[model samples]
Target: MLQSFKCEACKSNNQPSVSNHKDNSHLPDCKDEISLNTIGVIKTMFLEKRAVPRQASEAARIISRIELNSRIFNNPEHSLEGLETFSHIWILYYFHRNQIHLKSKVAPPRLGGERVGVFSTRSPHRPCPIGLSLVQLDRIDNGTIYFYGTDMVDGTPVLDIKPYIPQYDVPRKIERQEFFSPREAPDGEENCESVKTASTSTSGNLVSNVTVPNWVTNCKYLSVTFNETAEQQLQELAVEKKSITEILRADPRSVYLRTKYGSQIYTFQLGENTVTCKFDDQNSIVNVLQVRKVVILGDIPVSDDE
Candidate 1:
């Protein structure tokens, strides 16, 4: 059943080997490739990858819609019969915009540009360009599912949708206490601590303690402010101040941009318009400057009046 070995061609024993896999009929016989098709296409205000939030929770105010493809289902409406009962759903989509390359390590924004294994962080540039997000289900109409809290860009190819059932999805807490050595802990985890003891539950259903890096648990949010001119522009455009504040609080900038272009004007597209702002590094605040229509005349961006 369980086995570990390397191919004959590999010279080093240090080469990656597959192990601990219990061979069974449930496992597919396919050797190299697996085929998948798009089930639907998602529409959202994030027109570009740079503008999309880093996490769904960061953009809780935004709503996105998934238009199911009829060709993928015999009767699309019938397929979604029992899904309306759930308040949340998991969306598995393809990261179509990511560049074709793999990196062993990545720098997470929260860590102040420290490198970590790619698997440790939710980077889109993985071996398989797939994304997963749990969003609050707003409503379901005929072949469309509208949900809030989206980090996906517009026109994303959705692979599947599954209802969020807590009992099935959430892992059971440990009914018994246990401690692990620092070597046993995950890579980012340093201190050895005791696992939480849970109330009496069914035997063999509980899981060991889960530990996350301190940086993940303690996130830093930037204070957002709007000038009189920016506030007036937002009012004129009928944009919610809270929506802009939520996005800016998350500080949606890559580490490279934040480091190199620290003093440059920060701009991101919101709907059909572009929002421009400045970061006050000394005060850790984001001061919104203005919102302008994204009209391009050659390389120059023109205002709505122009």
Candidate 2:
């Protein structure tokens, strides 16, 4: 059971004190318990946590499926009335595999391990441990939805689904801006404007102008290359090389691994095969070492006679 409380400071008109906020005694005891149920489960290529992309958009080439629970719906087919019209959908799912504690600040991989407010980055370690992803809708059959761009594990529980409407989702007043990254800044120069496009809103409740540090905008992606052995193996397995290239180019390694381990051998399960690769950090290249089929040790083979 999830428990929550109401704070008295929220009831007051004046701004609440931040210094003695936790030690205050005027707060009343109004405990509220909330419960949520899963509407469906998502099926993806990622079987483990090692190589799942940090964001669904990073894995745009990957396809996934969502199977709604039949027990929860009287008419599963009727429940999904007109979701196919939209090209994309939003998935709200629980971070069931997250074991880390809540953090006020986190270091995103793209930031090169620079610490920032947890809210600024899309880290899984949150107060609620709930995840949100926007994926392209391919098709729908009955209560099942086939989508592209999934970052979740194979059996992630989906809480809810919503169609993506551009008018409601996208903001107005988008333009290009220049900002120099900290690493690339010239000597004796504290700040410099570089390049990128952003949106600003003057009328609505949104911030007048959106601003971000140079590191956020100056992200560099690693180039992926397959060797002769890996290329032959991929052909033998009949795996699409483009899919593997897309996943590797995003550099799925966590900040901890990238910072501590540096260039090392990384292995991840891709479909029914295990992919092994070596990271060349200096050149920002990922060389595919080999691809092999995953073997399950315990299962006995069934024959036609049985």
Candidate 3:
């Protein structure tokens, strides 16, 4: 079950030899650069990389489907052996859109564009562009894996998959290594104090032994409503009324966008349609102004089978 409490601070396939990505400091004495290939590709609602949720948790209920490269991931019937036994799986993929370069320092949204070491944050601009995510395993059918809670953009290259064993993945007791505490702004409740940081400790880790502030694990989202035209269009499309709401409630803005343009009319790709959302930061209300089917060239224009 989803639990709520505070004190925060947190947070491919191909089957080919992945490039060894060293952090800001690359080992000059180590081997040369390596080559990595895509094991499979993924399909998500995000047609482009504009308003993607920074973390998978921000878009938990959004469904994403993954297909392996048949040329490499053969034996479809047996490929996902014993995968169904677990409730979650790890997705390893490449940042196909990442440029061919590396940066020692980056500005993270969480720190309001504060310059921090590339190794200190999850920025894609790294020595090697790779991604790892843990998603709830909805089910597996044929050679495809259907799951929820993905931050991947459409057509993401998935490299590998592995079952999640609690004993091996989940720690018995979590040490307070995180520097964040959740922000608690509730109905008739004001959010307590928060201290966002981009500094590392002398020991080469994030701020250790930091104070965790009271944060909100969940918030009541304003029930999204549509106009007459949008309502009729939504009914015709057979889209759930809650699907758009969930994304808004999760606050699609990255830490940078939120700090910069929280009141702007945020537009994002939703399936084959475009959704325009205007959020009221004070009351936590999201207004769905428009939902129109758009022509996205890279969009998968069709539904998946099996």
User: Largest TM-score belongs to which candidate?
Assistant: 1
Task: Quantify all predictions' global Cα lDDT against the true fold.
Answer: 0.79, 0.79, 0.67
In candidate 1 the C-alpha lDDT for residue 24 amounts to: 42
Stronger candidate by lDDT (2 vs 3): 2
TM-score of 3: 0.66
| Candidate rank order under TM-score | 1, 2, 3
Lowest lDDT block of 10, candidate 3: 192-201
Off by over 4 Å in 3: 1-30, 174-232, 254-262, 281-284, 295-306
- Of the two candidates 1 and 3, the one with more favorable lDDT, higher being better, is 1
Candidate 3 structure quality by residue, lDDT tens digits, 1-37: 1233211221112221213333525323233666766
Ranking by lDDT: 1, 2, 3
Per-residue lDDT of candidate 1, residues 1-306 (tens digit): 225554543324344344533554433333466689999999998888875788898889888899999999977888898788778899999998887447888888888799899888888888778899999999999989999998999999999998775444566654335344124445334231222222233224544555678878898899999999899988888888888888988899888888888856888888778888999766789999998777878987666756
Per-prediction TM-score: 0.78, 0.76, 0.66
Where does candidate 2 stray beyond 4 Å? 1-32, 174-211, 299-306
Top candidate by lDDT = 1
Worst 10 residues of 1 by lDDT: 190-199
- In lDDT terms, how accurate is model 1? 0.79
